[model samples]
Target: MSNTTRSKPNKPDARAKLLDAAFSLIRAKGYCATSVDDLCREAGVTKGAFFHHFKSKEELGVAAANHWSEMTGIFFATAPYHDHQDPLERVLGYLDFRRAILQGEVREFTCLVGTMVQETYDTAPAIRAACEASISGHAAKIEADIAEALARAGMKPDWSAKSLALHSQAVLQGAFILAKANGGAEIAGESIDHLKRYICLLFNRS
Candidate 1:
């Protein structure tokens, strides 16, 4: 036998390819419209490979949401916003970070889980629940900083950190929809701008 290099195929590699394809295709086409065939085509994997990894398309959706959460969790954890010593500054810095990241195509900048949940909320309960977990999980991260900011500021207001954090996600998901409908990123940026302002006003910052 000739000495030659060959790659050892791994199940995770194929599963990851399918999940990555789902992230892109679902963002572009939404959940109901992005069929399994499209995922296979985009992922450059066979139907057998697809089915070998995922029991069904819905199962893939659930995995995609979880994977998206994992990927983004790391992305935000090490972000520059966390560098600020002051908790409130960190919160504002998080807003700035969000605004700075709106510098790509609509699908590229938008949330994959958000894109999926909108269309699947009623028709696909599993996907919807997975999406809710992903969104709420990310919001929980923000809520931690917000809660710290609230405690440090000694602000005893009616509103809660959890609510504000989830509201931030709502604005972002809605901004993505506006970006899709208007066929540009400007609207999304403007929406983030407004969100930033709202947060600043909430904390009584100029």
Candidate 2:
């Protein structure tokens, strides 16, 4: 006989459900509009489960930021950096990934940290600090990539990797903002094109 019963409420990972719900809602509806009830409803979990995992919505936001950082870090880890023999091509490949994101093929250009940074950077010190730290960590990773490219080319960097990384992050973040503001991908793609030119100018490679 076939028996059918309702699935367990605490099925799968409750914390993962909560995080997924929070990330989706925040991405879809923005951070300010997402609430505990919204997350619980979206995750099909109970309030007890939500509160059991996260003490507050702000805590969940921080957790979501960390999750995003981890997920994207993994993406960059295996991205097409080694696809081309030229070190400059590797750098260009990295920037091209950013362009794809702007084009909304793999992931939207919307960055969780960038979203939060725009809203609370000046007013909310804790949230701003979290965003700042995440951005800094990402910048460091890009710096390492830039250093690798320089080393592979047998050329010493006139500028520090950290500075180049910071610039790259700034350009990418700005492109995201323009994309969101313009309500289209044109601005983002164009901005990145300019950024690509800037990168070529800096490295003296095209």
Candidate 3:
């Protein structure tokens, strides 16, 4: 074998860095507040490199939203949902995960979709649509998990899975908003605990 190894191309490296930087910055700041210059700086790449990878900031925002959705969807799907035998326990575990994420204090209290919705919904329709789509996708994943729990318990719901899914999204997103407004994660967790109770009641009723 030759002593020298082949070097990876710069294009993929630049693209990955840009995406990672966009993800971090958008999560820290809202999409509208994060400029292309900021993204380039965060990525440690020049504006020319950033433009080479993403034609426009809107395009980069959409890609970041997609990346966020894919990553978080996998996390929620595999997280301790089936740990308990009872459906109610499983539901509470999901809520507990959300609470832990809130209280961890390592990450900022920002959901990509929520950030985009608040920042770019009126200005950028495509970016807004991407965020909305990501929200719906998360809801669907949660709904499927809930449906699985219902099946395991030999129970059925009067409402469709989609309704339950949307409700879950609303609860969590509302909790985030409350946390932001209240200047702490405690209020958000408390508000979400009520949602936990609601889910338990729903599970018992089914």
Candidate 4:
């Protein structure tokens, strides 16, 4: 009798698995280093499945950015930081929450879109645009709180809420890079602490 080999069954959510795998692998190895085969193996799916969902690696990069935005948007929306009645408190709480969540491996905590944009921004316009949208979309979610905080404090700042919101992301992405260089989360936490202090000073809460 001939030996029989059994193939693993396909996951009902293969697309989501691919996105999750891409997010993790890309964060660890970066866009240029990760390949279609890496994603397929990581996702436990075949190249055929991957191509069926995403036309190419570049297409997957764009989808991954959008996936990152959706997953993280839901995460922050349901986070406890929003429970504060005061908008300024909510804003500060959001930063505090960010700090609190920094206990993990660098790849685990770092932003996927941030990593991808740094690598592919010059080479891939579609991926870059998707990353920009993901980052800016997340920023816009907090812009309302920043605007309300500024108004409640009776402060006339030179910067718009959109700019300040973007600034916070800039600080975070920079912190992630520094942490990656330094090989620890302490520097990243300190960066966030400084950001919190800047926010306090801005709002005259310090």
Number of backbone-clashing residue pairs for each candidate, in the order shown: 0, 0, 0, 0
Location of the lowest summed lDDT over 10 successive residues in candidate 1: 1-10
Worst 10 residues of 4 by lDDT: 1-10
Instruction: Determine the backbone clash count of candidate 4.
Output: 0
Off by over 4 Å in 3: 1-12, 85-88, 104-109, 151-158
The TM-score between candidate 1 and the true structure equals 0.92
lDDT of 1 by residue, 70-174 (tens): 778777888898989988788778878877777657777788888888888998899999999999998998899999988988897899999999999999888
Whole-model lDDT for model 2 versus the true structure? 0.72
lDDT of each: 0.84, 0.72, 0.74, 0.85
Which stretches of model 1 miss by more than 4 angstroms? Answer: 1-12
Q: Spell out the clash pairs found in candidate 3.
A: none
As for lDDT, the candidate ahead, 1 or 4, is: 4
Candidate 1 residue pairs in clash (backbone atoms < 3 Å): none
RMSD to truth, every model: 6.5, 6.9, 7.0, 7.3
Clashing pairs in model 4, backbone N/Cα/C closer than 3 A: none
Q: What is the TM-score of each candidate against the true structure?
A: 0.92, 0.83, 0.82, 0.93
- Please, what are the lDDT tens digits per residue for candidate 4 over residues 116-206? 9999999999999999999999899889999998888888888898998999999999999998999877898899899989988888896
lDDT of 1: 0.84
Measured with C-alpha atoms, the lDDT of residue 50 in candidate 2 is 86
Instruction: TM-score winner between 1 and 2, please give it.
Output: 1
